[model samples]
Target: MTDTDVAPDTAAWRTPHGTSQSVSQNHLAGEVWMLLRRNIREALRSPVIAFIFPVLFPLFAETLVASSYARVSSLESFPIQPYTAYMAPGMMLLAGMMGSGYSATALVLDVQTGFLQRLRLLNVRPSAILLSRIIFDALRVLPAAVVVLLVGLALGARLESGPASVVGLLVMCSAWSVAYGGLFYIVALTTWNPQAPLAMSPLFILLMFTSTAAMPTSLQPGWLASLAHYNPFTYVTEGARALMTGPVTAHALLPAAAVLVVGIALTQGFVIPLFRRAVER
Candidate 1:
């Protein structure tokens, strides 16, 4: 139909996919918000929610770990922490890492579908494409975060500092999610492969395994031990654990924040260029 045949509100108003929407003035934030909102809504829908493997998988893993460790009644004799309490932060990080696959795959799909191209013509900001993916992934992980936290609590995980600590940890996780997700999006856009994000699992798993997530760094040996020292996951896990367990200190928070900032810096460095290329294409 011609523009004259459509309502004024409908005319020139369109979603990034060329669908009808109540379009108005364009700005970077608005564009990002639209993309983020669309992503979240679609994610919550049926069947597609299969993408929630990140959140659900962590809960299952945490439960199994807690159970397996529980079998060793000797675990309680440890002077350190209870099994549940120690595993909570690790599970939280796992969820965040897993959920990021959605954003990466979505970025690749957008590239394949020419969605990014359409957005460019509308004068959408180059950064917005990448930024939206980061923001959306962070928000998308919230439900999984909540599920993991609740599962940890159910499994007898204690949050010594109460609500404030939980909130602080969540904020930190969200930031990390954004940073990590941005990196995934960069790879997705560069490779133009939706499966690229799937390949990320083994790498992140290796990182988590080598880090202090599953055990304290003290037990590690040789180069395996060295990875624990520099791995971002280790700092993030310890930082989050500190927040939940009380006595938040620069010792914990600073290193975590530094890793997150460094990761973000690296992701943005590549994403900005990839986004520019997307726009130019």
Candidate 2:
């Protein structure tokens, strides 16, 4: 056989190889599943420390505030039932935030240990890596949400909306989880200093106090009320609260969507660059 005869066979083999590589690139399904499974196993093996801060702190806050607030007739409008209901979703968000924070910390560790570099070299889709981390964080929040819901029920909380609405509420909360996780991804990428997130922890606590979680908007001081009007967290808490209580308002959905959008945009801005930097190394 001459070179011309060999050339066609070589081309044929190259074609199949290229096609296989393309297919492999597109299909990261196995990689994502494996990553998710590994995350779950690690979570299960770990101590309940993650659960303690996200789950217990919120429950403790609800218990303390509900008991104290129940006593004052002046605060009767914000009763235990509605108050606990209002606070439940905030707790859910907090759970997600904490989950994301811890996951980011882990990512930082992976970066320092050079595991992230190894991940970048793999055939796995670039998106799959970030998505897998978010999925892991979201899964961590699920049990905490369940625990909060049970506590709410025990505290006389009830959902006025039907099952569909409840599901919507869960979906919205999950979106917040992913959005917040994305923000953490940014933090992880920009700086390796653990203190960066620790410094901003107070902002989370302040968000709860500024929102409708603790009291009605009407009851808030004038300046705080104005601030709450623009706060995205208030929208989420109110959206969840409206679903939990009677008199659902369409307005709540708008801000919930807004927060989700804004959160996504802000997260992407940081995450994309961070991802590129990681891949470059």
Candidate 3:
């Protein structure tokens, strides 16, 4: 049996060193820590998934697109000088979104291998696995997000808001990534089909292009502008841009925060039940 499968000593449990509830909580915490470490190691082992695609690919795309569109910012209607500055925040967000597929696919592999079933047999709490996966997925984006931002800086994207805004920007990206990734998790759990999440993966590209990611809403065509106005990603991108660039105000950040809160509440509300049902089967 694996380390996770080895139960704590029964005699130790009977001792009064700790209350049963406290001991159980400690046990769950240990399990989560171990699982999280495993997940992180797995991610690091695959550099393509862990870094290249999420970091380099987005940076490349941003660089190419921003270069081609650099002159767009010279228009009187545009506010930012270099197009890369306008695109950087959205590209960083894109880096986070791109990694969601791997996270969902990893969960599918665990299901196919009966790992979750084994954990269940060991009396591991579902919450432990869920928390570990969620935390891992949230963390998986940070390195890529930071790299993309740094690349943008090299490409002449200025962070007018100063150093402290970096924290806020990363936090916004992480929150949005978690909330966005929950959809893939729900699909993976519900269908138990590894291809399901990957199949719908184009939605990430679609959402990014349909939002204010490529250009400010004012420059978009009327139909596209209207669509972007309703896209949740628009708020996220706008908020992230505000943090990185300027206009650090509630009017800029509140809508994004609200959208993230609601999205997390809705998606995670479904993910838990779906995950429980999938593992039990």
Candidate 4:
């Protein structure tokens, strides 16, 4: 009911001799960890947004594409043996993309419900608030990434590389998701509207379709090929493909890494300031 009534262990207190004091400092790392756990638990309670769609949508897309386009692998010019193998990396990336926006939407909901204000009242740092959500956003897609990879193997994909590359590929997918989802955070924080994130959902489809996700650029029409050349996700997909299939060379990985780094830097450069202002408002 009052500070005096609070347990000493959980609250700041001075020794009887006044020789020392225990400060209940809201450390950034500790606060972020606590809030990240809360976010994960809350998401698990509503698994549809946090889990189901992320896994299912990518699985469906991969299966549907592989089934319809199985003949592509038979072509002499095709890169991989089974078309499913080629489709696997892109599908994993798509899972990362699909699993995003939940954090931004959740953050907006928290604001609307006054939960963020409550956290502020408790002296939680703004950086902790935003960083926890960002980390949660990256972590939430991991299950879907794993599921899609397993399904790809089941559907006739092969892992030419060893287990280490698989881990690297998954990590790349999570980082890509964080970068791609930055737009949603910017929109949500800028507008303070839950619906704003939904409007950006079509960008996922556009990115996949316009890029070399499902098909190589050589077979694409002139316009589509031109688009694929500039689409950053194409590099991500190709780099992921190299990791899973073969030739884990710098040629593929470097461009993807650079694109990811720039995407993350640019979007977060905007998002951090925007989120801080939003929460402080």
Candidate 5:
């Protein structure tokens, strides 16, 4: 079985007590998995908060946005498919962003409660600590991933790229969630406040609306269309919608990853060092 599949505490039985430099790669990996699993468990501990809520939030968002355009045949007089189908991919990305908040909240707790200090005493690898929490946060978001896709499928969303697109979409969503989650965690670590990251909530929501999220840019006013065209989330939504309509090609997928790449590049410079300092403190 993989390290994640086993009991997390079992690592306590296997990890050799020694300096971080002396630890084998495999053992370090095991430690990372242990911490990753722990974070997942912590995040998912509340059923209402973790399970039912994530599943329902996407459905709620889709209905609300879809309802707004219900009376209109099409926004720009373009050939409009079902509103559900048009809105699904954007809703999925929004859900991923919402689900990432729990990771930041948990990190804030770690900072405030001195749990990070204990980890530093253990001599854990800084990368392992940060990456594991971020990866686990992505895992914790699986309910959103599955429930949103299922809702879309039921509402006439099709995977036009076939089986491959199914896997590709999941990978894309996971990457986006991890990158943003890591960014949120960094904000919490630096502020050392559980509520500091909440300020980001409005910014992200605005980004979603200003993009080609609910309606295509052609439907928007000239100014809004211009603004949406420049938004990174526009590319992300277009990339995802392409997977549902046509082919999962490099041309279709690269823009989706570009936002994530920029997120990682910008956040990595800050998150890793910030996390290290938090541990050192």
Candidate 6:
């Protein structure tokens, strides 16, 4: 046959058929499970390092502040259930930040190593990469949180809220973790520099200090208090705190929801275009 008369290999060149498409769809699911397992394995390999912050921070705070605050009636006015009630939210935020930051750094490494490009060329779903990273982050934080919670309970930290509140708190904390992870996605997508995560470090520190983590807003300077009042993290901490303590406040819950919504929108806005550019590059 003449060259023009010869048909192309339709089987090879054509788009994936039913089984192939099913496999492609399942690719991400399989990868997610594998990625999660890998993350757990890595974390297990470094137990002390992984557990240090989540476990110790709450204990230290409870030991130091819980008694002093308990003695002072003025400070005691704030819902002071188990010191864990206050400490848990802060730990949650810290875990979220660390997880997201580390995930972003990992993304940078993947980009540098050309893994991102290889993944892009494959039939993997784009969302799966980000989702898996987030899942890994959440799972990484869980062990630490569990350790801290157990310690807190041993230390007489009580949860005044019902089962629903406990579930809600965990769910909200997870959402916060995912939202922060998305923010990291933006950072990783926009910057190629290995040190880019450093830019976020100050912000993380600022968030911890500005919120109700270390001290009540009433104790903070007026200007600092105002900033914290407006800070979205303040809401998250407050909401989580309310969930643990008895007196749930509208002030905390409303702002937390608002912040979550705004964060999701802002992160997506930046991440989508940044991801596209990174993929194209």
Which has the greatest TM-score?
A: 4
Which regions of candidate 6 are displaced past 4 Å?
A: 1-59, 64-76, 81-84, 248-251
Candidate 2: where is the Cα deviation over 4 Å? Answer: 1-26, 72-82
Q: Which has the better lDDT: candidate 4, or candidate 6?
A: 4
- Writing each residue's lDDT as its tens digit, candidate 6 over 1-281 gives 12221112111212455222222546667756644554455455556544454455545655666556544424555546544556666665565555355666666766676665655555555666666766776666665565655565666665677667766666676667767767667776777765675467556668877877766777678998988877778888888777766567787688887887788778767876776677668
Quantify how close model 5 is to the true structure by its C-alpha RMSD in Å: 4.7
Best by lDDT: 4
TM-score on alpha carbons, each prediction: 0.85, 0.82, 0.89, 0.90, 0.85, 0.76
Candidate 3 Cα lDDT to native:
0.82
Off by over 4 Å in 3: 1-27
Q: Please give the clash total of every predicted structure, in order.
A: 0, 0, 0, 0, 0, 0
Worst ten-residue run, lDDT, model 4? 1-10
Off by over 4 Å in 1: 1-24, 45-51, 71-79
Off by over 4 Å in 4: 1-24
Q: For each candidate in the order shown, give its overall lDDT on alpha carbons.
A: 0.72, 0.66, 0.82, 0.84, 0.70, 0.63
Residue-wise lDDT of candidate 4 within 13-85, one digit each (tens)?
Answer: 2357754342227468887887787788778777997889888878987799689999988988788879999
Worst ten-residue run, lDDT, model 1? 1-10
Candidate 2 lands at a TM-score of: 0.82
lDDT of 4: 0.84
Worst 10 residues of 2 by lDDT: 5-14
Error of model 1, residue 271, in angstroms? 1.2
lDDT of 2 by residue, 1-281 (tens): 23442233223213444642222344577666756765565456554645556677778776787667654424656543545665676666666555456667666666676555545544456676667777776667777777777787788677777666666666666777777777666777788865465455556677777877676677789998988887777887777766666457778777778888888788877887787677667
TM-score of 6: 0.76
- Ranked candidates (lDDT, high to low): 4, 3, 1, 5, 2, 6
